[model samples]
Target: MSVIIDFFDETNEVKEEQIEMIQGLINLTAQMEEVDEAEMSITFVTNERIQELNHQYRGKDQPTDVISFAMEDMGEGEVEIIGEESARLLGDIVISIPRTKEQAEEYGHSFARELGFLSVHGFLHLLGYDHMTEEDEKVMFKKQKEILHAYGLER
Candidate 1:
Protein backbone atom coordinates (compact mmCIF):
# COMPACT_ATOMS: atom_id res chain seq x y z
CA MET A 1 0.00 0.00 0.00
CA SER A 2 1.26 3.39 -1.00
CA VAL A 3 -0.20 6.63 0.36
CA ILE A 4 1.11 9.82 -1.13
CA ILE A 5 0.07 12.99 0.65
CA ASP A 6 0.79 16.48 -0.59
CA PHE A 7 0.64 18.73 2.44
CA PHE A 8 0.43 22.53 2.32
CA ASP A 9 0.30 24.92 5.24
CA GLU A 10 -1.17 28.14 3.95
CA THR A 11 -1.50 29.48 7.50
CA ASN A 12 2.23 29.04 8.23
CA GLU A 13 1.39 28.69 11.91
CA VAL A 14 1.90 24.95 12.10
CA LYS A 15 4.94 23.61 13.90
CA GLU A 16 7.29 21.13 12.27
CA GLU A 17 6.21 18.28 14.55
CA GLN A 18 2.59 19.02 13.75
CA ILE A 19 3.29 18.64 10.06
CA GLU A 20 5.07 15.36 10.59
CA MET A 21 2.29 14.07 12.79
CA ILE A 22 -0.37 15.02 10.28
CA GLN A 23 1.52 13.28 7.51
CA GLY A 24 1.95 10.17 9.63
CA LEU A 25 -1.72 10.19 10.50
CA ILE A 26 -2.70 10.33 6.86
CA ASN A 27 -0.39 7.49 6.00
CA LEU A 28 -1.65 5.43 8.92
CA THR A 29 -5.25 6.05 7.92
CA ALA A 30 -4.51 4.79 4.43
CA GLN A 31 -2.69 1.74 5.69
CA MET A 32 -5.40 0.85 8.15
CA GLU A 33 -8.03 1.15 5.45
CA GLU A 34 -6.00 -1.04 3.09
CA VAL A 35 -5.82 1.51 0.33
CA ASP A 36 -3.35 0.75 -2.42
CA GLU A 37 -1.48 3.48 -4.25
CA ALA A 38 -3.58 6.53 -3.42
CA GLU A 39 -2.78 10.23 -3.66
CA MET A 40 -4.39 12.83 -1.43
CA SER A 41 -3.86 16.50 -0.63
CA ILE A 42 -4.16 18.23 2.71
CA THR A 43 -4.05 22.01 2.98
CA PHE A 44 -4.00 23.98 6.20
CA VAL A 45 -5.71 27.32 5.86
CA THR A 46 -7.17 30.19 7.82
CA ASN A 47 -10.75 30.44 8.95
CA GLU A 48 -11.51 32.96 6.22
CA ARG A 49 -10.45 30.67 3.41
CA ILE A 50 -12.32 27.71 4.87
CA GLN A 51 -15.41 29.84 5.41
CA GLU A 52 -15.33 30.80 1.77
CA LEU A 53 -15.06 27.18 0.79
CA ASN A 54 -17.88 26.17 3.14
CA HIS A 55 -20.20 28.86 1.85
CA GLN A 56 -19.36 28.05 -1.74
CA TYR A 57 -19.49 24.29 -1.55
CA ARG A 58 -21.59 23.44 1.50
CA GLY A 59 -23.72 26.60 1.40
CA LYS A 60 -22.88 27.62 4.95
CA ASP A 61 -21.53 30.96 6.08
CA GLN A 62 -19.48 29.82 9.03
CA PRO A 63 -15.99 28.43 9.10
CA THR A 64 -15.56 24.67 9.45
CA ASP A 65 -12.81 22.69 11.14
CA VAL A 66 -12.21 20.50 8.11
CA ILE A 67 -13.74 20.06 4.67
CA SER A 68 -13.10 17.23 2.24
CA PHE A 69 -13.76 17.13 -1.48
CA ALA A 70 -13.66 13.57 -2.72
CA MET A 71 -12.47 12.98 -6.26
CA GLU A 72 -14.59 9.83 -6.69
CA ASP A 73 -17.75 11.10 -5.08
CA MET A 74 -20.17 9.78 -7.65
CA GLY A 75 -23.89 10.02 -8.00
CA GLU A 76 -26.31 7.08 -8.14
CA GLY A 77 -25.45 4.58 -10.84
CA GLU A 78 -22.21 6.40 -11.54
CA VAL A 79 -19.21 4.16 -11.41
CA GLU A 80 -15.53 4.92 -11.70
CA ILE A 81 -13.49 2.10 -13.19
CA ILE A 82 -9.73 2.10 -12.75
CA GLY A 83 -6.98 -0.37 -13.49
CA GLU A 84 -4.80 -2.07 -10.91
CA GLU A 85 -1.72 -0.01 -11.67
CA SER A 86 -3.57 3.31 -11.56
CA ALA A 87 -3.45 5.31 -8.41
CA ARG A 88 -6.67 6.53 -6.82
CA LEU A 89 -6.84 10.29 -6.77
CA LEU A 90 -8.47 11.27 -3.52
CA GLY A 91 -9.48 14.90 -3.47
CA ASP A 92 -8.51 17.70 -1.14
CA ILE A 93 -8.87 18.25 2.60
CA VAL A 94 -8.76 21.83 3.87
CA ILE A 95 -8.34 22.43 7.61
CA SER A 96 -8.77 25.61 9.57
CA ILE A 97 -5.82 26.37 11.83
CA PRO A 98 -7.71 28.70 14.16
CA ARG A 99 -10.51 26.23 14.56
CA THR A 100 -8.03 23.51 15.27
CA LYS A 101 -6.50 25.55 18.05
CA GLU A 102 -9.86 26.29 19.60
CA GLN A 103 -10.93 22.68 19.39
CA ALA A 104 -7.71 21.48 20.92
CA GLU A 105 -8.25 23.81 23.86
CA GLU A 106 -11.93 22.99 24.10
CA TYR A 107 -11.40 19.23 23.97
CA GLY A 108 -8.45 19.43 26.35
CA HIS A 109 -6.17 17.63 23.96
CA SER A 110 -2.82 18.50 22.52
CA PHE A 111 -2.57 20.53 19.32
CA ALA A 112 -1.04 17.59 17.54
CA ARG A 113 -3.94 15.35 18.57
CA GLU A 114 -6.53 17.78 17.28
CA LEU A 115 -4.68 18.20 14.02
CA GLY A 116 -4.26 14.46 13.70
CA PHE A 117 -7.98 13.95 14.30
CA LEU A 118 -8.84 16.44 11.60
CA SER A 119 -6.36 14.89 9.21
CA VAL A 120 -7.67 11.37 9.73
CA HIS A 121 -11.23 12.61 9.67
CA GLY A 122 -10.66 14.24 6.32
CA PHE A 123 -8.87 11.21 4.96
CA LEU A 124 -11.82 9.00 5.95
CA HIS A 125 -14.10 11.40 4.12
CA LEU A 126 -12.00 10.95 1.01
CA LEU A 127 -12.54 7.20 1.36
CA GLY A 128 -16.34 7.75 1.39
CA TYR A 129 -16.83 7.85 5.13
CA ASP A 130 -19.42 10.27 6.48
CA HIS A 131 -21.28 11.16 9.63
CA MET A 132 -24.65 12.06 8.23
CA THR A 133 -26.38 9.35 10.27
CA GLU A 134 -25.80 8.02 13.75
CA GLU A 135 -24.55 4.69 12.51
CA ASP A 136 -22.30 6.28 9.96
CA GLU A 137 -20.93 8.67 12.52
CA LYS A 138 -20.11 5.78 14.80
CA VAL A 139 -18.30 3.96 12.04
CA MET A 140 -16.42 7.00 10.78
CA PHE A 141 -15.44 8.35 14.18
CA LYS A 142 -14.41 4.91 15.36
CA LYS A 143 -12.10 4.52 12.41
CA GLN A 144 -10.69 7.99 12.98
CA LYS A 145 -9.91 7.23 16.60
CA GLU A 146 -8.32 3.93 15.73
CA ILE A 147 -6.05 5.50 13.16
CA LEU A 148 -5.08 8.35 15.46
CA HIS A 149 -4.36 5.96 18.28
CA ALA A 150 -2.26 3.80 16.02
CA TYR A 151 -0.28 6.86 14.96
CA GLY A 152 0.31 7.74 18.63
CA LEU A 153 -1.87 10.83 18.43
CA GLU A 154 -4.39 9.62 20.94
CA ARG A 155 -6.00 12.18 23.15
Candidate 2:
Protein backbone atom coordinates (compact mmCIF):
# COMPACT_ATOMS: atom_id res chain seq x y z
CA MET A 1 0.00 0.00 0.00
CA SER A 2 2.34 2.71 -1.21
CA VAL A 3 1.07 6.18 -2.08
CA ILE A 4 3.09 8.84 -3.82
CA ILE A 5 1.93 12.33 -2.94
CA ASP A 6 3.05 15.61 -4.49
CA PHE A 7 2.08 19.08 -3.37
CA PHE A 8 2.40 21.90 -5.87
CA ASP A 9 1.72 25.57 -5.23
CA GLU A 10 3.55 28.87 -5.05
CA THR A 11 2.31 29.90 -1.63
CA ASN A 12 4.66 29.91 1.33
CA GLU A 13 2.22 30.70 4.10
CA VAL A 14 0.63 27.28 4.44
CA LYS A 15 1.44 25.81 7.80
CA GLU A 16 3.55 22.69 8.16
CA GLU A 17 0.89 21.16 10.39
CA GLN A 18 -1.74 21.68 7.72
CA ILE A 19 0.45 20.07 5.10
CA GLU A 20 1.03 17.12 7.40
CA MET A 21 -2.68 16.79 8.07
CA ILE A 22 -3.52 16.80 4.37
CA GLN A 23 -0.87 14.18 3.69
CA GLY A 24 -2.25 12.10 6.52
CA LEU A 25 -5.71 12.38 5.01
CA ILE A 26 -4.43 10.96 1.74
CA ASN A 27 -2.82 8.01 3.48
CA LEU A 28 -5.86 7.34 5.64
CA THR A 29 -8.27 7.56 2.72
CA ALA A 30 -6.24 5.13 0.64
CA GLN A 31 -5.65 2.74 3.53
CA MET A 32 -9.26 2.60 4.67
CA GLU A 33 -10.32 1.98 1.08
CA GLU A 34 -7.49 -0.53 0.47
CA VAL A 35 -6.07 1.03 -2.66
CA ASP A 36 -2.85 -0.37 -4.12
CA GLU A 37 0.15 1.75 -4.88
CA ALA A 38 -1.97 4.85 -5.32
CA GLU A 39 -0.56 8.18 -6.41
CA MET A 40 -2.15 11.58 -5.90
CA SER A 41 -1.31 15.25 -6.43
CA ILE A 42 -2.59 18.20 -4.46
CA THR A 43 -2.25 21.84 -5.43
CA PHE A 44 -3.24 24.82 -3.38
CA VAL A 45 -4.02 27.84 -5.50
CA THR A 46 -5.41 31.33 -5.23
CA ASN A 47 -8.85 32.26 -6.48
CA GLU A 48 -7.60 33.34 -9.88
CA ARG A 49 -5.79 30.11 -10.62
CA ILE A 50 -8.62 27.95 -9.41
CA GLN A 51 -11.07 29.95 -11.44
CA GLU A 52 -9.09 29.22 -14.58
CA LEU A 53 -9.00 25.53 -13.72
CA ASN A 54 -12.70 25.42 -13.04
CA HIS A 55 -13.45 27.07 -16.33
CA GLN A 56 -11.11 24.85 -18.28
CA TYR A 57 -11.85 21.55 -16.60
CA ARG A 58 -15.46 21.91 -15.52
CA GLY A 59 -16.53 24.82 -17.70
CA LYS A 60 -17.91 26.62 -14.67
CA ASP A 61 -15.76 29.76 -14.95
CA GLN A 62 -15.76 30.30 -11.20
CA PRO A 63 -13.52 29.54 -8.29
CA THR A 64 -14.78 26.72 -6.10
CA ASP A 65 -13.40 25.56 -2.82
CA VAL A 66 -11.98 22.33 -4.26
CA ILE A 67 -11.93 20.17 -7.37
CA SER A 68 -10.81 16.59 -7.91
CA PHE A 69 -9.84 14.81 -11.09
CA ALA A 70 -9.76 11.07 -10.49
CA MET A 71 -7.96 8.83 -12.98
CA GLU A 72 -8.51 5.32 -11.64
CA ASP A 73 -11.57 3.14 -11.75
CA MET A 74 -12.58 2.39 -8.15
CA GLY A 75 -14.55 -0.78 -8.93
CA GLU A 76 -17.14 -0.54 -6.18
CA GLY A 77 -14.67 -1.05 -3.31
CA GLU A 78 -13.44 -4.27 -4.84
CA VAL A 79 -9.95 -4.91 -6.17
CA GLU A 80 -8.89 -1.69 -7.93
CA ILE A 81 -6.93 -2.92 -10.87
CA ILE A 82 -4.02 -0.99 -12.24
CA GLY A 83 -2.46 -2.17 -15.47
CA GLU A 84 0.22 -4.75 -14.84
CA GLU A 85 3.51 -3.01 -14.12
CA SER A 86 1.91 0.41 -14.21
CA ALA A 87 1.58 2.67 -11.17
CA ARG A 88 -1.95 3.69 -10.20
CA LEU A 89 -2.70 7.37 -10.49
CA LEU A 90 -5.59 8.31 -8.24
CA GLY A 91 -5.93 11.93 -9.37
CA ASP A 92 -5.30 15.61 -8.75
CA ILE A 93 -6.93 17.75 -6.06
CA VAL A 94 -7.00 21.49 -6.59
CA ILE A 95 -8.01 23.71 -3.70
CA SER A 96 -8.67 27.43 -3.75
CA ILE A 97 -7.02 28.97 -0.71
CA PRO A 98 -9.00 32.20 -0.77
CA ARG A 99 -12.26 30.39 -1.26
CA THR A 100 -11.43 28.04 1.57
CA LYS A 101 -10.84 30.97 3.88
CA GLU A 102 -14.12 32.59 2.91
CA GLN A 103 -16.07 29.37 3.28
CA ALA A 104 -14.51 28.64 6.66
CA GLU A 105 -15.61 32.02 7.97
CA GLU A 106 -19.00 31.80 6.30
CA TYR A 107 -19.70 28.32 7.62
CA GLY A 108 -18.37 29.21 11.07
CA HIS A 109 -15.81 26.42 11.13
CA SER A 110 -12.12 26.51 11.74
CA PHE A 111 -9.89 26.92 8.70
CA ALA A 112 -8.27 23.62 9.46
CA ARG A 113 -11.61 21.87 9.65
CA GLU A 114 -12.78 23.24 6.31
CA LEU A 115 -9.53 22.40 4.62
CA GLY A 116 -9.53 18.90 6.06
CA PHE A 117 -13.10 18.32 4.95
CA LEU A 118 -12.28 19.45 1.42
CA SER A 119 -9.23 17.22 1.30
CA VAL A 120 -11.20 14.21 2.48
CA HIS A 121 -14.02 14.96 0.09
CA GLY A 122 -11.66 15.17 -2.84
CA PHE A 123 -9.92 11.98 -1.76
CA LEU A 124 -13.23 10.15 -1.63
CA HIS A 125 -13.93 11.20 -5.20
CA LEU A 126 -10.64 9.68 -6.19
CA LEU A 127 -12.02 6.54 -4.58
CA GLY A 128 -15.08 6.77 -6.90
CA TYR A 129 -17.55 8.46 -4.61
CA ASP A 130 -20.00 10.86 -6.23
CA HIS A 131 -22.56 13.22 -4.82
CA MET A 132 -24.86 13.46 -7.82
CA THR A 133 -27.79 11.47 -6.48
CA GLU A 134 -29.34 11.37 -3.05
CA GLU A 135 -27.97 7.93 -2.23
CA ASP A 136 -24.59 8.77 -3.64
CA GLU A 137 -24.52 12.03 -1.73
CA LYS A 138 -25.41 10.17 1.45
CA VAL A 139 -22.56 7.71 1.00
CA MET A 140 -20.00 10.28 -0.05
CA PHE A 141 -20.99 12.80 2.61
CA LYS A 142 -21.06 10.13 5.27
CA LYS A 143 -17.63 8.90 4.32
CA GLN A 144 -16.27 12.43 4.27
CA LYS A 145 -17.66 13.18 7.71
CA GLU A 146 -16.45 9.88 9.08
CA ILE A 147 -12.90 10.38 7.86
CA LEU A 148 -12.78 13.97 9.09
CA HIS A 149 -14.17 12.90 12.45
CA ALA A 150 -11.67 10.10 12.70
CA TYR A 151 -8.96 12.68 12.22
CA GLY A 152 -10.63 15.04 14.73
CA LEU A 153 -11.61 17.55 12.04
CA GLU A 154 -15.36 17.27 12.40
CA ARG A 155 -17.56 20.29 13.05
Candidate 3:
Protein backbone atom coordinates (compact mmCIF):
# COMPACT_ATOMS: atom_id res chain seq x y z
CA MET A 1 0.00 0.00 0.00
CA SER A 2 1.30 3.42 -0.97
CA VAL A 3 -0.35 6.28 0.88
CA ILE A 4 1.03 9.76 0.37
CA ILE A 5 0.26 12.15 3.18
CA ASP A 6 1.02 15.79 2.48
CA PHE A 7 1.06 17.67 5.74
CA PHE A 8 0.55 21.43 5.94
CA ASP A 9 1.29 22.75 9.37
CA GLU A 10 -0.25 26.20 9.49
CA THR A 11 -0.10 26.28 13.28
CA ASN A 12 3.48 25.08 13.52
CA GLU A 13 2.48 23.35 16.73
CA VAL A 14 2.69 19.81 15.42
CA LYS A 15 5.64 17.84 16.75
CA GLU A 16 7.83 15.60 14.66
CA GLU A 17 6.64 12.60 16.63
CA GLN A 18 3.01 13.46 15.89
CA ILE A 19 3.76 13.68 12.18
CA GLU A 20 5.40 10.27 12.21
CA MET A 21 2.56 8.77 14.15
CA ILE A 22 -0.06 10.24 11.81
CA GLN A 23 1.79 8.96 8.79
CA GLY A 24 1.89 5.52 10.31
CA LEU A 25 -1.82 5.59 11.05
CA ILE A 26 -2.64 6.76 7.53
CA ASN A 27 -0.53 4.02 6.03
CA LEU A 28 -2.04 1.41 8.28
CA THR A 29 -5.59 2.57 7.51
CA ALA A 30 -4.91 2.47 3.82
CA GLN A 31 -3.37 -0.95 4.00
CA MET A 32 -6.15 -2.30 6.18
CA GLU A 33 -8.76 -0.95 3.78
CA GLU A 34 -6.84 -2.32 0.81
CA VAL A 35 -6.29 1.05 -0.83
CA ASP A 36 -3.30 0.20 -2.94
CA GLU A 37 -2.48 3.77 -3.97
CA ALA A 38 -3.91 6.92 -2.42
CA GLU A 39 -3.00 10.47 -1.47
CA MET A 40 -4.38 12.83 1.14
CA SER A 41 -3.51 16.12 2.81
CA ILE A 42 -3.50 16.86 6.51
CA THR A 43 -3.46 20.48 7.64
CA PHE A 44 -2.78 21.57 11.19
CA VAL A 45 -4.32 24.92 12.01
CA THR A 46 -4.95 27.11 15.02
CA ASN A 47 -8.17 27.12 16.95
CA GLU A 48 -9.16 30.40 15.36
CA ARG A 49 -8.50 29.07 11.88
CA ILE A 50 -10.37 25.89 12.56
CA GLN A 51 -13.28 27.77 14.04
CA GLU A 52 -13.53 29.74 10.86
CA LEU A 53 -13.58 26.56 8.87
CA ASN A 54 -16.14 25.04 11.18
CA HIS A 55 -18.43 28.00 10.78
CA GLN A 56 -17.97 28.18 7.06
CA TYR A 57 -18.24 24.51 6.25
CA ARG A 58 -20.20 22.96 9.11
CA GLY A 59 -22.15 26.02 10.20
CA LYS A 60 -20.68 25.78 13.68
CA ASP A 61 -18.64 28.60 15.12
CA GLN A 62 -16.69 26.52 17.60
CA PRO A 63 -13.41 24.97 16.71
CA THR A 64 -13.60 21.26 16.04
CA ASP A 65 -10.84 18.78 16.69
CA VAL A 66 -10.80 17.57 13.10
CA ILE A 67 -12.68 17.81 9.83
CA SER A 68 -12.49 15.59 6.75
CA PHE A 69 -13.33 16.28 3.09
CA ALA A 70 -13.48 13.10 1.06
CA MET A 71 -13.07 13.21 -2.68
CA GLU A 72 -14.82 10.01 -3.65
CA ASP A 73 -18.27 8.73 -2.82
CA MET A 74 -17.17 5.21 -2.04
CA GLY A 75 -19.45 2.54 -0.70
CA GLU A 76 -18.75 0.68 2.49
CA GLY A 77 -15.93 -1.86 2.17
CA GLU A 78 -15.07 -0.58 -1.27
CA VAL A 79 -11.66 0.52 -2.51
CA GLU A 80 -11.22 1.99 -5.97
CA ILE A 81 -7.94 1.87 -7.81
CA ILE A 82 -6.95 4.74 -10.07
CA GLY A 83 -3.68 3.48 -11.54
CA GLU A 84 -0.34 1.93 -10.53
CA GLU A 85 1.84 5.03 -10.37
CA SER A 86 -0.98 7.48 -9.89
CA ALA A 87 -2.81 7.53 -6.59
CA ARG A 88 -6.38 8.51 -5.81
CA LEU A 89 -6.83 11.89 -4.16
CA LEU A 90 -8.60 10.97 -0.97
CA GLY A 91 -9.30 14.57 0.06
CA ASP A 92 -8.14 16.56 3.09
CA ILE A 93 -8.18 16.48 6.88
CA VAL A 94 -7.99 19.69 8.86
CA ILE A 95 -7.08 19.56 12.52
CA SER A 96 -7.05 22.18 15.21
CA ILE A 97 -3.82 21.93 17.17
CA PRO A 98 -5.04 23.88 20.19
CA ARG A 99 -8.25 21.90 20.34
CA THR A 100 -6.34 18.65 20.10
CA LYS A 101 -4.14 19.67 23.01
CA GLU A 102 -7.12 20.68 25.11
CA GLN A 103 -8.97 17.47 24.29
CA ALA A 104 -5.91 15.38 25.15
CA GLU A 105 -5.75 17.05 28.54
CA GLU A 106 -9.47 16.76 29.04
CA TYR A 107 -9.50 13.08 28.10
CA GLY A 108 -6.44 12.42 30.28
CA HIS A 109 -4.48 10.75 27.52
CA SER A 110 -1.10 11.24 25.94
CA PHE A 111 -0.87 13.81 23.16
CA ALA A 112 0.30 11.12 20.80
CA ARG A 113 -2.76 9.03 21.50
CA GLU A 114 -5.16 11.90 21.01
CA LEU A 115 -3.45 12.94 17.83
CA GLY A 116 -3.55 9.40 16.57
CA PHE A 117 -7.24 9.16 17.37
CA LEU A 118 -8.06 12.37 15.58
CA SER A 119 -6.02 11.36 12.57
CA VAL A 120 -7.65 7.99 12.41
CA HIS A 121 -11.06 9.52 12.89
CA GLY A 122 -10.53 11.87 10.00
CA PHE A 123 -9.13 9.08 7.84
CA LEU A 124 -12.15 6.96 8.54
CA HIS A 125 -14.42 9.79 7.49
CA LEU A 126 -12.51 10.01 4.25
CA LEU A 127 -13.16 6.34 3.73
CA GLY A 128 -16.97 6.89 3.90
CA TYR A 129 -17.43 6.18 7.56
CA ASP A 130 -19.66 8.32 9.76
CA HIS A 131 -21.22 8.40 13.23
CA MET A 132 -24.46 10.27 12.66
CA THR A 133 -26.54 7.42 14.07
CA GLU A 134 -26.10 4.94 16.88
CA GLU A 135 -25.32 2.02 14.62
CA ASP A 136 -23.07 4.16 12.46
CA GLU A 137 -21.29 5.40 15.53
CA LYS A 138 -20.69 1.86 16.69
CA VAL A 139 -19.22 0.75 13.41
CA MET A 140 -17.13 3.86 12.91
CA PHE A 141 -15.82 4.07 16.44
CA LYS A 142 -15.08 0.38 16.53
CA LYS A 143 -13.05 0.67 13.35
CA GLN A 144 -11.26 3.68 14.73
CA LYS A 145 -10.34 1.84 17.91
CA GLU A 146 -9.17 -1.15 16.02
CA ILE A 147 -6.92 0.90 13.77
CA LEU A 148 -5.47 2.85 16.66
CA HIS A 149 -4.84 -0.25 18.72
CA ALA A 150 -3.20 -1.95 15.79
CA TYR A 151 -0.92 1.06 15.47
CA GLY A 152 -0.03 0.78 19.17
CA LEU A 153 -1.71 4.09 19.96
CA GLU A 154 -4.05 3.16 22.73
CA ARG A 155 -5.62 5.44 25.29
Candidate 4:
Protein backbone atom coordinates (compact mmCIF):
# COMPACT_ATOMS: atom_id res chain seq x y z
CA MET A 1 0.00 0.00 0.00
CA SER A 2 1.25 3.41 -0.92
CA VAL A 3 -0.04 6.57 0.79
CA ILE A 4 1.29 9.81 -0.58
CA ILE A 5 0.75 12.93 1.53
CA ASP A 6 1.39 16.35 0.05
CA PHE A 7 1.67 19.06 2.66
CA PHE A 8 1.28 22.82 2.15
CA ASP A 9 2.34 25.08 4.93
CA GLU A 10 0.62 28.43 4.70
CA THR A 11 1.15 29.21 8.39
CA ASN A 12 4.92 29.00 8.61
CA GLU A 13 4.50 28.07 12.24
CA VAL A 14 4.22 24.35 11.75
CA LYS A 15 6.95 22.44 13.49
CA GLU A 16 9.10 19.70 12.00
CA GLU A 17 7.78 17.22 14.52
CA GLN A 18 4.23 18.03 13.50
CA ILE A 19 5.00 17.30 9.89
CA GLU A 20 6.62 13.98 10.75
CA MET A 21 3.72 13.06 12.98
CA ILE A 22 1.19 13.86 10.25
CA GLN A 23 3.03 11.65 7.77
CA GLY A 24 3.28 8.79 10.23
CA LEU A 25 -0.41 9.04 11.11
CA ILE A 26 -1.43 9.09 7.46
CA ASN A 27 0.60 5.96 6.76
CA LEU A 28 -0.83 4.21 9.79
CA THR A 29 -4.38 5.22 8.87
CA ALA A 30 -3.96 3.95 5.33
CA GLN A 31 -2.53 0.65 6.54
CA MET A 32 -5.32 0.10 9.04
CA GLU A 33 -7.96 0.92 6.43
CA GLU A 34 -6.39 -1.28 3.76
CA VAL A 35 -6.08 1.60 1.32
CA ASP A 36 -3.64 0.70 -1.43
CA GLU A 37 -2.12 3.46 -3.53
CA ALA A 38 -3.89 6.51 -2.22
CA GLU A 39 -3.11 10.21 -2.42
CA MET A 40 -4.12 13.04 -0.14
CA SER A 41 -3.15 16.64 0.57
CA ILE A 42 -2.77 18.41 3.89
CA THR A 43 -2.56 22.16 4.21
CA PHE A 44 -1.60 24.06 7.32
CA VAL A 45 -3.24 27.45 7.34
CA THR A 46 -3.78 30.36 9.68
CA ASN A 47 -6.96 30.79 11.70
CA GLU A 48 -8.32 33.41 9.31
CA ARG A 49 -7.87 31.24 6.28
CA ILE A 50 -9.48 28.27 7.97
CA GLN A 51 -12.34 30.43 9.18
CA GLU A 52 -13.02 31.54 5.66
CA LEU A 53 -13.07 27.94 4.46
CA ASN A 54 -15.26 26.90 7.34
CA HIS A 55 -17.81 29.57 6.58
CA GLN A 56 -17.73 28.96 2.87
CA TYR A 57 -18.01 25.18 3.06
CA ARG A 58 -19.74 24.45 6.35
CA GLY A 59 -21.56 27.78 6.78
CA LYS A 60 -19.97 28.13 10.18
CA ASP A 61 -18.37 31.52 10.56
CA GLN A 62 -15.54 30.45 12.78
CA PRO A 63 -12.15 28.87 12.71
CA THR A 64 -12.09 25.12 12.89
CA ASP A 65 -9.30 22.76 13.76
CA VAL A 66 -9.74 20.67 10.63
CA ILE A 67 -11.80 20.25 7.48
CA SER A 68 -11.90 17.38 4.99
CA PHE A 69 -13.00 17.21 1.39
CA ALA A 70 -13.53 13.73 0.02
CA MET A 71 -12.98 13.30 -3.67
CA GLU A 72 -15.72 10.80 -4.37
CA ASP A 73 -18.53 8.80 -2.86
CA MET A 74 -17.89 5.23 -3.82
CA GLY A 75 -19.69 2.04 -3.01
CA GLU A 76 -18.97 -1.59 -3.75
CA GLY A 77 -17.32 -2.11 -7.12
CA GLU A 78 -17.18 1.65 -7.65
CA VAL A 79 -13.90 3.08 -8.90
CA GLU A 80 -12.65 6.50 -9.88
CA ILE A 81 -10.01 6.52 -12.60
CA ILE A 82 -7.42 9.25 -12.42
CA GLY A 83 -5.11 9.11 -15.41
CA GLU A 84 -3.89 5.50 -15.84
CA GLU A 85 -2.57 4.90 -12.36
CA SER A 86 -5.92 3.85 -10.79
CA ALA A 87 -4.86 5.61 -7.66
CA ARG A 88 -7.52 6.43 -5.05
CA LEU A 89 -7.84 10.15 -4.51
CA LEU A 90 -8.62 10.32 -0.84
CA GLY A 91 -9.07 14.12 -0.95
CA ASP A 92 -7.82 17.01 1.13
CA ILE A 93 -7.40 17.97 4.77
CA VAL A 94 -7.02 21.58 5.88
CA ILE A 95 -5.90 22.36 9.38
CA SER A 96 -5.62 25.60 11.29
CA ILE A 97 -2.19 25.86 12.85
CA PRO A 98 -3.17 28.71 15.14
CA ARG A 99 -6.25 26.91 16.39
CA THR A 100 -4.23 23.77 16.94
CA LYS A 101 -1.77 25.62 19.11
CA GLU A 102 -4.50 27.24 21.15
CA GLN A 103 -6.37 23.99 21.54
CA ALA A 104 -3.24 22.23 22.66
CA GLU A 105 -2.75 24.76 25.42
CA GLU A 106 -6.45 24.68 26.28
CA TYR A 107 -6.47 20.90 26.51
CA GLY A 108 -3.14 20.71 28.26
CA HIS A 109 -1.47 18.54 25.65
CA SER A 110 1.53 18.87 23.42
CA PHE A 111 1.21 20.59 20.06
CA ALA A 112 2.27 17.43 18.31
CA ARG A 113 -0.55 15.45 19.91
CA GLU A 114 -3.17 17.96 18.85
CA LEU A 115 -1.83 18.10 15.34
CA GLY A 116 -1.81 14.33 15.11
CA PHE A 117 -5.38 14.17 16.36
CA LEU A 118 -6.56 16.61 13.70
CA SER A 119 -4.71 14.80 10.94
CA VAL A 120 -6.08 11.40 11.91
CA HIS A 121 -9.54 12.84 12.34
CA GLY A 122 -9.45 14.39 8.90
CA PHE A 123 -8.08 11.22 7.31
CA LEU A 124 -10.91 9.20 8.79
CA HIS A 125 -13.38 11.64 7.29
CA LEU A 126 -11.83 11.11 3.89
CA LEU A 127 -12.46 7.40 4.47
CA GLY A 128 -16.20 8.08 4.89
CA TYR A 129 -16.18 8.27 8.65
CA ASP A 130 -18.54 10.81 10.19
CA HIS A 131 -19.27 12.11 13.65
CA MET A 132 -22.66 13.68 13.03
CA THR A 133 -24.60 10.99 14.84
CA GLU A 134 -24.09 9.46 18.24
CA GLU A 135 -23.17 5.97 17.06
CA ASP A 136 -21.06 7.34 14.30
CA GLU A 137 -19.19 9.58 16.72
CA LYS A 138 -18.58 6.62 18.99
CA VAL A 139 -17.12 4.51 16.22
CA MET A 140 -15.13 7.29 14.62
CA PHE A 141 -13.67 8.60 17.85
CA LYS A 142 -12.87 5.08 19.00
CA LYS A 143 -10.95 4.31 15.84
CA GLN A 144 -9.12 7.62 16.04
CA LYS A 145 -8.10 7.05 19.65
CA GLU A 146 -6.91 3.53 18.93
CA ILE A 147 -4.83 4.66 15.98
CA LEU A 148 -3.29 7.55 17.90
CA HIS A 149 -2.51 5.39 20.93
CA ALA A 150 -0.90 2.75 18.75
CA TYR A 151 1.22 5.46 17.15
CA GLY A 152 2.45 6.47 20.63
CA LEU A 153 0.56 9.77 20.48
CA GLU A 154 -1.64 9.34 23.47
CA ARG A 155 -3.52 12.03 25.37
Q: Which regions of candidate 4 deviate over 4 angstroms?
A: 74-85
Candidate 3 lDDT by residue in tens digits, 1-155 = 88899999998778898898899999999888898889999999998999999999889989899999898876689898676667788899999888888999999998888989999999999989999999999999999988988988878
User: Per-residue lDDT of 36-155 in model 2, one digit per residue for the tens?
Assistant: 787889898999998998999789988898999997755466685646776678889988888888999999998888888898888888788999999999999988877777777767
For candidate 4, the per-residue lDDT at 112 reads 90
Query: Each candidate: how many clashes?
Result: 0, 0, 0, 0
Local error of candidate 1 at residue 94 (angstroms): 0.2
lDDT of 1 by residue, 1-155 (tens): 77788889898898888777777777777778888888888899999999999999999999999999999898689788777777899999999999999999999998888888888888899999999999999999888877776777768
Give the least accurate 10-residue stretch of model 4, judged by summed lDDT: 73-82
Root-mean-square deviation of Cα positions for candidate 1 versus the true structure, in angstroms: 1.9
Q: Which wins on lDDT, candidate 1 or candidate 3?
A: 3
- Residue pairs in clash, model 3: none
Report RMSD (Å) for each prediction in the order shown. Answer: 1.9, 4.1, 4.0, 3.0
| CA lDDT for candidate 3 | 0.90
TM-score of each: 0.92, 0.88, 0.90, 0.92
